[model samples]
Target: MPLINSDTNNVNNRGAFILFEGCDKAGKSTQAKKLFEYLKNNGHSVELWKFPDRKTTIGQIINEYLANDKDLDDKAIHLLFSVNRWECRKDMKNLLLSGTTLIVDRYAYSGVSYSVAKGLDLDWCCSSDRGLLSPDIIFFMDLTAEAAEKRGGFGEERYEKKSLQEKRIVESSLKLIENCNQLPLKEDLWKTT
Candidate 1:
């Protein structure tokens, strides 16, 4: 687990934004689904959202790129991802403002790192997603390369293979966090592990 940041205060009666972010096969989806079910069963107003929301038109293009069905310029791909997130901004804000807690499976950090891993500029990657929406609490799931490989469907995604520039992925992750630290967002962006 990475260093935890203290929980943030939810002001104005807004719902909590709980986010699960990590590398491939880190159990982010499982944890997020379980948490969503738990909250729902417990009668909390909640919703779950995932980035690269493949259901949308922009997301379809993203899916094509991720699936290797099509090729795109690194910057073009990054912008598409940013647009994917942007499309949900209004609805997400409405839900949160209406006191509906949102359990987000993945967010801008993952997209930024992926772009950086592909050799895009860090600031350029982050710029498109700037002030999108900050999570009240982020669960950063960390898994070793071997452990991640042991799980099923490990190599299904383009970035899943370790022998294929995994170092860049790790480096990009570090750069993502470092760049995030530069922005004066929430001091307590990190929470319990």
Candidate 2:
């Protein structure tokens, strides 16, 4: 027989999914870490996740593919990135169910924004990430491409080229601003504070 007690069996409040989105050099990593530590110190169970989670096997392949300019079809690489997210979906779900807050440095929105920013259809880009866990809050960190480039040493990665990154930044901003404005809340797409 099973223990039968409504008081004991009641579900506790689950964790929140907070996502941070931004162009390169938006200082998302630094702020995310700070927020995670603050939450943990306050006694909340928390998990910090960075997308393109480059430590996993799939991520390793993606990293190599991006680093060396290894040629792959646009759709192929896009799908691979999406699959990477799928691979982690179960874990994210369990973490939320277990009442542990998950802080993501980047989530599906990055995939859509960057890919579509390359000229893929915005609808298509968004479609790829549909049905994944929707975040309770998405923090978009905004910065101008010029400011990001001025930070220097911009060629550390494949996507670091100033010109291309600028295009990405512009397209991503338009997509986010448009989408967010239509939401009922209608707050600024990035940097609430």
Candidate 3:
């Protein structure tokens, strides 16, 4: 028998990992879905995943807390959301290896941003997403809180309150991109004053 080449055996023609990031009501989801459909129609096998999937077991806990006013501690809910993504990580890798393009609505960045925005440890947030496949292209849909709130029902979720979101969006944008780049200097990803 011929010697097996480990590189060839492991190498797969994965398409790409595309990610969209933004604050709440920034139209990131709408744009992500549109991009996914467009890619699908172009004969590309594609998959869509949203962070805190909120359907898985861990996500269910997060969903209950966010939606039902359940008494889960802040850190607990934050970690549950992080675990939710970790649980699906295998499938995420498998799909990418199977030549399917992944159009993720939100990914580790949002997890870090939103979690750290709540005064949790930024380093902890960054560490939670360690080892996740880096995105081929990351698109950040920029929007202002004033404009976003005008879209209606912005205060529906636990983190969607106007004051908190505005503060987090501003604070987290710079920190999030800094973490994304792992750079010493913080860069603002979203264009807001």
Candidate 4:
């Protein structure tokens, strides 16, 4: 993978904010953790962060919603997802300013894309996440819906199913890449042994 450094005005120059985004079972968490471990092992400061943290109040609601245990309005859930990230904004900025790289499993892109797939207004979804920290480099794991379905945990969560909806989510994710630096990862490169 190509590692792209960030250009920032922070006193310490700040650390790179790297993000991994893709459909369910696309190995975002796995690759993010691996990158975090690699950076740490090399004596660099690094952190691995995931969305819907499931530990905070907002995240708990998100967790329940994802599990299909609780029903939520589309706008409500979308805002909650954005709020979940906002809750971490301070700490994220602090870590980066302190020169610690962050390997994130997901971010605003997922929130906007998934919600938009459900027929929400794209502008509205994007508005909720304004002023969030943007990633210095985003790695889009380009996995087809068919390929993702064959992986484990394909149908356990609300968004894991392979369908036309998921295809749209994947397509929507591409929209976020246009103005940002991208490092595309082919499926073969991410396959587990």
Question: Best candidate, TM-score-wise?
Answer: 4
lDDT of 2: 0.73
Better structure of 3 and 4 per lDDT: 4
Q: For candidate 2, write residues 88-188 as lDDT tens digits.
A: 98898777766789999977777776777677777666666665776767888877778887775556777767776778777675566458532232111
Model 1 TM = 0.84
**lDDT, candidates in the order shown:** 0.77, 0.73, 0.73, 0.77
Which portions of model 1 show Cα errors greater than 4 Å? 1-12, 163-165, 183-193
Looking at model 1, the pairs that clash are 5-190
90-170 per-residue lDDT for model 3 (tens digits): 787677666788999877777777777788887766666666666767888778878888887787888777776777788
TM-score of each candidate? Answer: 0.84, 0.82, 0.84, 0.85
Considering lDDT, where higher is better, how would the candidates rank from best to worst? 4, 1, 2, 3
Q: Write the per-residue lDDT of candidate 4 for residues 114-188, one digit (tens) a residue.
A: 887888887788887877777777898767888888888788888776774365555577776664423222222
Off by over 4 Å in 2: 1-12, 177-193
For model 3, name the residue pairs that clash: none
